[model samples]
Target: MKDNPLIKTLFAGSQPPHLIDPLALFLLVLIPIGALPLSPSEEIHLFLARTSLLIYLGLRSIQGLIWTGRRNRSDGWVTSISWSSSLFLGIGWGFLSLSWSLSPFTSRSVFLDFFLYISVYGLMTQASLPGKTVKTLYQFLVMMALLVSLDGLSQKFYRYDAYLPYLTEHPEKFDPHTLEIMKNWITTFRRISAHFLLPSHLAGYLILIIPLNVALIQLTPTLWKRVSWLLVLGVNLLVLFFTESYGAWLSLLVVFAFVLLYPLVPRLRRLGRATLQEDSPGQTPGRLLKTIPGIILLSAGTFIVLTLIGYSRGTYLWDLNAPDHPGYLRFLNWKSAFLILRDYPWTGTGLGTFKIAYPPYMLPNSTEANFAHNSYLQIGSELGLPGLLMVCLAAITWFLKGLTTLSTLSDPEDRIIYRSLFAAGLGFCLHNFVDYDVYIPALGLTGFMLLGLGGSGNAEEGEPGRREEPSPLRPSPASPFFNIAWPACLLGLSLWLFILNGKLYLVNIHINQVKKEMEQGEFEKAYQIAQKALFYDPGNPSLQEISGVLLLQLKQPERAARAFQKAIELDPKVPRFHAYLGETYLLRGDLAGAYVETKKAVELFPLRTSYQKRLEEISSLLEKYAVKNRKP
Candidate 1:
């Protein structure tokens, strides 16, 4: 406790205050916990992590963000990290676009994820990064990835469901359908989703982790560490192979080629050396291969070899089949995303609103795709052009800065460490061209952390094994008030977000409790718990829909109509909300309203046979009412 940074800084006579390292570890644990009990909706915020972060922010908000304990006026890389401002601005657009979000609740929930990621990046960049600290973080993440990979391998060789026997035996779970869906997703024939929602998400995690592990193998001097990392990488690559993700395979090849080009092409290496850590990942094969013609031939040959390997293994990298092919679905989603951007050019549909806004634009026979499959296009369609531009600029900046950081490292080990981060981040960026890691917290959090570590661990000349002082790239205000203002804003924002996050988490808990009670024939109890849940997250449409069902069961048609009406407002894209509202209208003897509402439900989701039949029933009822009116 005495050795703790926060402990030393506080309650000591002369020492200046410093923030603690707990925040750092929380950010690191994000990769693994991202997959577990958190699941899909619980991502509102990791309750414990967020609470601790809020406390940290509350303490720092008044003092300042960057600590001066190191250099006694030290500036950190938070704002100065090449493209961070643009990244923040892009996320800023995501926050502001909430006003127009197709589903305000979804936008509100997802924006926190982006906020948490950027905050993690900011917090990481501000802290001092010792080599041991870097190595430990790398090791922990590698082990976690290794476990996930091994689990995936086990699934491939042994069973279909990821942990069906372990997870499926619970009869008390509110929604058994969710478990069935999870089983279906994890059981992608001979492929491993690795407990991720989809195989592609596991592929996303793999591509990012493998390069970093390769970097580790190069950096570690000890044979044991090298062998350990190599084993991890080998397993990771094998899992990647099992995933059979065309984007992961092709993107990795592109990155490997880029790494190769760094050594082969002197002009290119020298060109980016001005402000980045410019270095190659692996050793050159031979001097003969460095010449222009030789390099071109080697590059082409390598590219062809990798491409052919994937093609021969049934990669389907460019399947032109218009239907039933993954690539074609991706193409259709991209096309649909463009149409979304065409209409909502200013702000698009809003952050996390893509799924809500996308259905109306889904192409015929496309099976109702959610994500755009391209992170950039989705960002454009969801957050608008400025948001897209900012994110792109930030990415380009991180890559360039990574190059600069690489060039400055005198030690081969240090250079390799930075290179691995650079390669992993670049690979993820390129991978996003055909997939959406943006929605996956595990991938996005890891990506941002890697991006922050881009220029970390730099040492000043002649100071071996010491952390470098951050170069001040912008003006720092010495005023106490200015410092207090920013931190206060962070504190205030965090406080509000923390409250909302708590609400969301509690709502998830209570709603599940409600469903369990309902399953056990406790309608009154379920209704009571549902109201409690809605009090926390009134914007949740599913909760509202459930409440309507409960109200109808309780024989309160007016209240049921109002509940379904609220659900429709919260999520107009859902067919059932409109259908339920139509049911309430019919109970009230409003035949015309019932017909119109049911018709809209069928129109919104023509694929739902149940909705179509309901619409037909409403139409027949309306016709009978019309015939009776004519007779009167």
Candidate 2:
């Protein structure tokens, strides 16, 4: 075995192989840093985190196309191809969804966010997972977890958080609604968000990172490293408890149980025994390095742990569908999402348009929400069932392929690390049942990175670091069809970013300006800004709605009516747009038009007291008109 270079470096305590890759180390570091501010789900625009990810992705794309040799063999095609293809279908479908999106402005922005992050997922799978890179990456996860936990503690005790302090200093940088949310988080809410925007989001991040700490504590090569990981894991758990996120608490218990106990199954035992036969000379016996590293009474152990924590401070167990229950609102959101799916089952309300489209379908007594609180339902409502199917398929492929890779690994340490990453990802997936983390760049990207690392596209002999003979010093041998196809994919992706995404960003800037002007009571200025925005994105329902509002404010009733009608054409599901159009009709003295449009608004959102009152007023006016006509 000409002793593996990585093995040599591990024992020798020499410099790790920098030649293998220094870029992935930078990427690994960037991810934890980026997750902080990018934690919230975007509404009509994107977070600045998108820029950093684009740069990271652009570097990786350059490396793939120019520096690294393209994969020529079918070594890990089952994992790589299947995962990428399914995700591609999901992304492609999301792109197509813009045509039917209820709010194309938001949809396009969200689609770009997903496209970039998922692209990170695909590229990361191909990243070479050598020993030093893997170890360093795990360290980064632990170190950042501890720091974020401390940040949460600060919010609890000192009433200050690292991620939100700057917002107070410069309120103008953020929108008024955003500032209100931040203020509410600090003053109105007791639970800590830390680097995230909500306690649930913080809990979601912990669920994604803590399992790796479990793996690290057991499977780390050194005693000091193991102790540190254990400490970090405890800190993260403490923060998770403080978050009072019941869903994450439950998800952690179940996923940890599965990871720790499931390996004791007879099949896994057989696999462990099989790996024992191939232990390396420097390594301990496989029996000494049991698959779970000795946490076998998982289900009972978790229960005792939960009891000791008092089931996590203020967190109650799963609730009945009561109005006051914490989860009741989520249940309402889910039911409404189901209705949205029923209405737009094929193309969906459009990718990332759930918050825009979901209002009309919300169950009675339900308030407006940004998410379905269920990733699967959100995906279904936003991207349609087929899109959901593709996402599910990608997850299935990652898990199964990762397990297959795990079973084949000859090295005990490699197996442990893989098992740990798998659990981290699995826990987050389970958490999504109650809290939708995948839409948030931080939580979603972290989970995907772990999943990607678990199934390396280059791993062949169950070894992430296993070396293969180098390809000849030339471009990868590909069929004529593939040679052109690969380049075409690149070209299309570039154009999609440059043309469509560029225009989206432009429109977003204008919309932001419009909002600022409107908030300042500068309706004329806002209307002018909106008009300019429409020149760029005439199809965006949001811009049209704002324009209608501005027109109404300017006392231009007929023009406002036209703008509202256009908004209805763009997104008929939004009841307020219809109501505004009805108001325009009322201003114009078209009693018939006012009655018809107001009736439609009331029909769409019967729970709206304002809409109902408006409808009543319209009916009264119509009656008056009829009586006057009869007298004449």
Candidate 3:
């Protein structure tokens, strides 16, 4: 107990305040257990849970630093070695990403966050209580699953049945120009709640966890233990079906197949096999109870019936082929992503820059898309192949390491747990072939938590070779350095990211609301909200476009023209900027000037027949105006 730095720091130079052993156990086990019931929130207050967890980790890191200082003074080198390796890998990727990103600022920030996550893992590796940390994470995952399951249920049984009114009313804010984006979004999805942003994402999220849930049901020792996992599996699957995301369903099938086949691979022969005697026999009463696959069938049946009922009422099953299904355009987006990759393969357009840059390339006949549905393509287009390769390699390394561990572990329960997690990770990897969930910070954070769980040894039993016999040479489990520093650092970084993400979310929501207000003809409200948005994201060209359009509507053409020019300067590649500028020039009766600008617009977007028509109109007007002036 004295070897763990976190424990030592708390008790150092003071009498024991409480039973340290019990406290350590509680921290290791219960912190994760306590988090199982979270629901996706519209309220900002939910940020507290993340804040608390950060505080907990920060204290742990401090404990580790203090303990290490008192023990062997040479331990700093070990910390430095681990951090250095992580830093080198991270910086290498960051520089490579900078070379390709369309939005270098956003790319750099994401890479920084990615690097911090890697550092956390490295620090975790050096900690003495890795098993406990792992256990804490597993408990956290189980709880998260439970919460998602419950949230999905509420969305189905309560919301769908009652047709619940908007849960939270947002203030209106956005100019008429920006509100145009909302019209397309409103018709895209039937239900757009926090629980399920898009059908595919919901399906993908649940699919990722199916393998883990299955493992829990199969490998857990007691019949009760196995049965407990069924609730989570049942709920998650139910929600997945409700989502009706075909891509997610397809991804799940692929991942589940791989997981089921993983154990049968010849290379896995080294992983010891379970003896026939250990398998529960068919005859025992308790064993018969264990074979109640009937419960699973019933649960599934109930879900299907509920889904059918929901479908009858028009609240279920998103058909990708339906006329109203805007998602069908994803095929074009996918193609465009490849085209963009070909054009800028080395460095991407920039992180978050694809949406801003991709629309002009779309066939003039079709609707514009918000994203290239494929995450890998999106990342590849933004950061280039090297950045993509770096991320892929990191994920592969972590996954294979986890797989190797799972295969070698002796405990059936632990092995099952790992197999399930591996399945979820596999599902996400597959899903990313056609979706961008991996880039979502909230989802990414949860994924990293799961990744941490995958790296953990058995918490209750401790990791192999971690036994304490109390040698003067061997550090005590309670050593201050072993426990404190790493946890503290992790907590601090995690909190900072969470806060940053929360603020970002608020900005997105506010921006969306502002645009809606603009659409409703609330120009004053829209302008007010747009200004506020500008305050938060002054560099956003889209926001500037909105401000410029609104200024034009208010009869400030010169100022509006300047704003349009600025938008072009910010991103000259956008054809609309030229078109808008030409329109502004025409309004000012500068026929020659208008013709020049209009011709530029037509040249930039040849397929836009409207732009060509406008160009012809300007040319004719300029010619007539020149002839009339000569007559004078």
Candidate 4:
């Protein structure tokens, strides 16, 4: 192996084992902090992280080919494969939908991002690392929790966000409308977002780490370490409570109940058996009867505490129409998602098409919602019911496998670690019921890493005497071409993706620049910048729409019509494109054309008062023209 040319180039003298653990740890640390830059969107961090991980995997693939001559296996692969295959099929179907996708560019980008996530999941499972690496990662997470808690607590107490000043200084790098939206949001909510876009995002991140902190406290032998972990846990809980994320609060309660009750199950079972076997006829009733008063007191106490908490927190969970209520907004978003699923039940409108597809389905007076706010509903709306089913199956399989592995581990420390990872996974699932935490790259990566660790550790606890067979993933000697070609293709694809995302990043910068130019009343300069952006992302309907609007402002209605028509041709689902085109037709004195386009716009978005008003005005004009023509 040392003498092999491939090994020498990729792995030999490279400290391969040391590299794997550090790279994994670096990713766990980098994702949250790397997300601090507010340029473009939080998704930019995901793009950067995914690109780095993909490149790392590409290099590891070359090393694996030369040294191991086989694909690596994890303990859960047998069970995982079924669910993984289904997920791949769903993503594959998303790619296939590009043919009919309303926004093909969005569909392509989303498909690529998801495909990379799947690749990362596989790589994490295969990458070998020491058990101590997991411990190190947990410690790093604890530090992060403390740091984020400090930031959040400061914002809550001081009434100022530290990151807000930095964002304000870099106005040109982000969307002003988005910044304005956040400014308005913070004024009313008073919640802390920390380094993320929303307070709920911070809460979501904490929920993932909180369980691990609990596990660390249980596993550590020293009182000092336990107290330190307890402090970190308390900080996270305080931040979570102040953030007022009902979903996260509910999830924490459930996870805590599970963690506390899990240890008592065996004892409870023993007590039940002992009572059954007692010779005295009254023993079973006596044992049960003695706990009745305590049970009643406990239930009453719990209800009183809950009432006090709800009142102090001002959380009227039962109120559906309360202003600024998350629960009410979630209901509207979920209803919209259901409507989208009803229309596109199987294949969906297309991946990343939610923003375009959802507007028409929104409830009356609903504010614009980019996400469904429920991960399951979002997945169903974007990928359809089949995709939803596949994702659910994959999550359930991962959880069951982790639990099974935790049961088999005899070491108390190892059991605690696995149990905590399992609980973290469950928390992610539950939080997503009212939020889209899984869609956040940092949280999603953390989750996948924990799952990978759980599955890998499970594989190590084996029978003492049995010899493990070589993984079937090994390439046969007859398929030497495949061994070479597979890795080569992955490397090439990763490079291509890197370049593609870089272009998109530049395109976003240019679009933001154009917006600044427009605000300064430089229509010609704005139009020119938009033209350049369109050249880079030719299929972006939003860019096309922007170009149309700028051309209209420049009084070039003919060119504006061409741009709007092009936008509609690219993504016919958007009502705004039709309305813009109708205005251009009206400018050209084409009453029939204006009437037709505006009517289409109204049909697409019936709740848009502007579109309906335009239609009415056009109808009155047509009616007046009809009377004059009849007299002639």
Candidate 5:
């Protein structure tokens, strides 16, 4: 080998390719960081987060378009189809976006939020996933989880009568009724929220991050790096526990089972078989990883041990029993949700409009409720079965595509990559089942990221599959059809946002009407106002709860109970719902039912002296009722 240093240097491949695209890297860091934890209650916080995501997505797409470089072979049909589908979906959701908006102001806010999700999807697709992007996202999720967990802990221990210290300090912004409902939370032990999103949402956020962390760990090289991932996971898991969000906890377990465990079935079959190894020069047979007969047993054993430790230590995993317990009000929420879903099986009241809409349909004699407590029912009652179906289809489609991509890949690394994506997707999907994390953009974005990972196609390693060769460099202006189509989609989306804004605004006005009427002791007028609000945004659970309260005030016990139940259904994790429903039962002279519900309210929120007092009063009433019944 003649040493011709200059010639050799000239021929040496242009400094090992920068695996990460700079634009993509910039975007990965900026978007999530821009959304960094803010006061959950602050509308500004949400607005900022939404803007950051949109900006990041725009930047990412431009980068992707530039990096991919316009090629002659670019499948115009495929690209058009994909973009068109996205546009249509966005338009549909945009229309939906207006359904539950509170006011012109709230409607505008909500429209922006809805549009943001569309932009996020477009941006995600545009910015093809790179290792650095994955790493950045992973780190963000981990940090967020940690912050939320820590905040949750602080909230619980510090007992904030005013505000969560790290978040916003605006009590004036909150609806007084909303404030009253959440007042009992001062007794909890963590800072899962600063009031913008609830503690349950904070917990759900952590659960969503865990899968991303797992994915990041799979990408790391060193054992220490892997262990660091474990640390992040552990911290998030611990914090999630403190949040007392059993729904999130259950969702996490479901994601683990669906993504990580289900894939293992095929792996177990290939367990003892030899496979090509990356380490061996020229692809040699690697040691066959064993598939133990007791793998299931081992998993079960590990789960058992963890469960024992968690239960003994009073971890969130065991907290689900709270809902199952006689004192926990989860059942009441479930009951209420079902009632709403059954009555409004189609064209739901409206998206995000459940609180106000569900009141008239609630169980009688109940206090006002603010949510459906259940994601499934809430969606069903708001957008109707079709809306629920649309969301479900979107979710399932994302998962199936991701799983398919992962299944066909042979490389262990690739498999892990896809698996991690699947796991992350599973986490969000599961989390949605119990807690409606979808309402919060930050959490929803995280979910969509996992979906994006699933939808994305990865480049093959080793004998690379015939790469989708880059298209020929050309300045292909938008086709006339495309120009028209793009504008049309934008116009449609705008129109929908406008309608949603109007609907939401009207609903808010109607809600305010009810509030004022209630203050004036005009229960019938309040009830009427609530009904009008439902006509505008039938899914407003707050309105529904208020309506139910008004009915109770009007001495309509059955109707009031029904309304409270509906509120619980729209949002089950909120403990006050049980108290409201229990009171309704008491007013109806159903002492036994009152005792049961009040007990549940007390259990879910031990800090609520109001709930405790109700429970005690109900218990005494029940005793007297029992004695009287026996004597009769």
Candidate 6:
């Protein structure tokens, strides 16, 4: 009998599947790029892509449970589960923190993203076979690197916004907050973001793919193929340099050092006897030696380019004392993050609460920053020490396991691939210490995908770990109730998430429309649209803030005050909510209330010049009125 249509749709066949098809892998690789849209922020794109991937993986997992007799023999479930448990526990704690989270809505969103990523990790580890998956990944990554690099070059040189076509042509669509960043591209220092939300994000993406491309170059047999891969690598490295992400640049340097030194290490060389002796034809010393001169030349050229750019921009690379310097800002952020972590040592303020919780703790002269610029510190400050430990343990476990596996590999190609993956993982971890590389969806997903591939024991062409034994076509011997119940639960959950994603998309559309209306000076229409949007996502502080602004513009200070108060109640850590409420109070002639609210705003974000200025202006007005009253 043929397999069930539902099972077929999920699994691709009745036979136990070993690997994801290249075509499907190609589609998966494109998710990060294709998810970008103009209507909402980058987070929405991440949400949509993650939701879709999770749903698809959920279906495949259900099918695996029903059709397969046991867990895939190729997947080292014990090792995988050991490391994966840490990740799960960390994320689970994040979900639990929603109850006490500074902003439950933000916590909920973060938890969902982590949940989806975990699902992807499981699906990839179970389904991917070694050779084909690596090949497919390399092909797709090279193409993506080339495409993004070209786009970045065009954007930097031609001042083009790659996302412009996705936006509506209406001038109102060009709102100051979202679209202004796109419009203001011509600065003394132009950093290309490609389609990502920031230049640093593009740098993270390039850093991730660089090692994989290096592996492909090592594996290519033909001269032209090698040259082509090298070209892609060069282009990507060039773009990465122009992104001016110091963390990414440093990470790339570390990766290059690892690759260049690996063969020279006596212990590692001893472990690679099979690759050195049996596969001598493919693993040539001359080929490896050639990379050194090229790497040196590339390094020297990069330094020269950076020096010239720094000179022209009047931003010396060594100038850390500058008020606006990224290094100085990062130092300040780390200091504040440590202070916040000290306050909540057991359980953090909450996941995704760092942005809200950090402003009040910022040092003088430091501006508002969302992330701590250090992933480990950000996680520690947001999710507490326990969560931080779990995440760290998970990463270490994956790296060690992959490195151990690489040490034992006999196949030349397999050894290279595993070494590349391990190096990439190490680079990513190192980069996170100085930058929020892991927060970027494209980079984060790619990192996890590499880990999944590394965990799957089937990377070689003739590896003994491959599942060659035939399996019975019958269903698993587990209870019929489990078989039916599990799939039904998965299907239901998938459907629910899909529905929720659609609703969220609709809400974003409505919010965008409200923004457009407000830009056109249509306060009443904007207020109505915001009210309707709030019906869908009432906890959204943004929509509430919009309603408050519109109400203030309509001369309804009482209603506006209520709106701003509601916004503050939803997310109390935001200074803008308090500032807006203070303005409303001032308009209503409630001087005492106005002073109280404005002072709260200043206390929350003392470094914000505008808030301080507003406070000063109000104080002067009160003094003038007091003088007038005394004279009368």
Backbone clash numbers for all candidates listed = 11, 0, 47, 0, 71, 1
**lDDT of every predicted structure (CA atoms):** 0.69, 0.68, 0.56, 0.68, 0.56, 0.70
Q: Which stretches of candidate 5 lie over 4 Å from their true place?
A: 1-29, 52-111, 153-183, 188-196, 264-344, 364-369, 458-479, 491-632
Give the CA lDDT, 0 to 100, for residue 238 in model 2: 82
Clashing pairs in 6: 130-458
* Per-model TM values vs. the true structure: 0.83, 0.79, 0.67, 0.80, 0.60, 0.83
Decide which is better by TM-score, 2 or 3: 2
Over 4 Å off, model 3 = 1-92, 95-101, 104-194, 215-229, 268-332, 360-367, 457-538, 574-583, 590-632
Of candidates 4 and 3, the better by TM-score: 4
Can you write out model 2's per-residue Cα lDDT over 133-163, one digit (the tens) per residue? 6667777777877888998888788855544
404-503, model 5: which lDDT tens digit per residue?
4554567665566666666766777766666676667676665665555455553332111111223335433555455334434444544555465456
Q: Please give the lDDT score at residue 614 for candidate 2.
A: 81
Candidate 3 matches the true fold with a TM-score of: 0.67
**Ranking of models by TM-score:** 6, 1, 4, 2, 3, 5
Clash count, candidate 1: 11
Return the TM-score for candidate 6, rounded to 2 decimals: 0.83
Candidate 3's residue-wise lDDT over 232-299, tens digit each? 78777777666656567667756655554454443543332322223345344454464345445544
Which pairs of residues collide in model 4? none
Candidate 2 lands at a TM-score of 0.79
lDDT at 142 for candidate 6? Answer: 73
RMSD of each: 5.4, 6.5, 7.9, 6.4, 11.8, 5.5
**What value does the lDDT take at residue 628 in candidate 3?**
86
